[model samples]
Target: ASTPSCGDGQCTLDEDAAACADDCPERAGCTGAEWYARFDPITQEIADTREAIAVAWYATGGSFDAARTGRAGDDPARTSDNVWTAPSEPGVVTLWIVLRDDRGGVSWRTLAIEVG
Candidate 1:
């Protein structure tokens, strides 16, 4: 039940909250690509808007549309509890919470949930 990793140069961490942000250079406005592994959205849909929810979107194991920002409610760290619904595609559609450590290495826990 782990999420995928986005690695460095492709993602960032939310200092205030316990979430990660994906690097999407093409995205406009405050919206950016992002993903999470541990946080589940389905279980959080009825919770308060302030709760953190895991989310991501991809196509064929590749980057699709980056996650939109401003969805994390009052959280100022740019983190969100939103669920990313990707377009229907072929191959493995991987989603994950890319984490970065002090060593500068990246790690991804597999969240291989197939997408159309």
Candidate 2:
């Protein structure tokens, strides 16, 4: 067996923190009191969700836009609410959240989610 490596551009369900940092980067501001996403059961089953999307956000970053891969549907909406949605599939979905500051400096974050 081989160890997982970050920045390989390939994010799999088996990948871990040391395996692929690019796909599983950490977000200090998007958890617990500052959660960014919520799964909607009404959308689809937990294992096979490639249609609907789960909402995501950036707790206190003003506001932002989003985009995703590995599914089918309209791209997640970009609004002040920062209501981005994850792909419905149950494994290894990539989500990119873009944040623009008032001065126009742009930055983003990515997550490799194993849905289920």
Candidate 3:
């Protein structure tokens, strides 16, 4: 398959506002929300440290302000935030949020957003 490029007029799975703002215009609005990562509290307390967590955002339509967001190992924050702009048309859009930790742990969540 060919690499997805901006100005193609087709927003592929890999394209978003950050990657192709022109092709995928930001239309929908989303409040800034926080997403949490799972971790062992005991280990975190013992080491006084936490694994770095990163989140990758994807959607079937619309666009995201950022491709990823996360907290570093040294940072105490347990959540990451991202803003999603919905597609211009009204429909059900599939969205995915994937989270990965510095220790190779990974998880993901799928959301069905109803745009009107």
Candidate 4:
């Protein structure tokens, strides 16, 4: 059987496993039930390394938002590059991220998600 890595945001691999034993030594295990992504080497070469991104979660009544502005590294483990979880409710959520130039113009990548 083959397990595919998801760059398409539909499915993802367990990314928080390595930190579990160390961070929660008394706990049995750590589970990462979230999406994961790595910066494409080809994309990184073309874009500014210090690019910024914004993350937002949409729920029934309102939205939750966060941002990683103008900082860069290729590590997917970093929270700044991507999100860990979507909303707990079974509704729509959106992640809006951007790789920007020094002039701070808008360049966006929108991830539409459904959470349950």
Best by lDDT: 3
Candidate 3 regions exceeding 4 Å error are 1-48
lDDT of 2: 0.44
1 or 3, greater by lDDT? 3
Residue-wise C-alpha lDDT for candidate 1, range 17-116, written one tens digit per residue: 1233444244353233233234447775444334232344333455534553223434546544445565456545656655332223343344554554
Q: How well does model 3 score by local distance difference test?
A: 0.76
Clashes per candidate, residues 3 or more apart or on different chains: 7, 7, 1, 0
TM-score for every candidate vs. truth? 0.26, 0.30, 0.58, 0.33
lDDT of 3 by residue, 1-116 (tens): 34659898966666778879988788653222334456557666333345678899999999999999987877766578899999999988999999887778787877777787
lDDT of 3 at 64: 95
RMSD (Å) per prediction: 17.0, 16.7, 13.5, 13.9
Q: For model 2, where is the 10-residue window of minimal lDDT?
A: 29-38
Off by over 4 Å in 1: 1-82, 101-105
Off by over 4 Å in 2: 1-88
Better of 3 and 4 by lDDT: 3
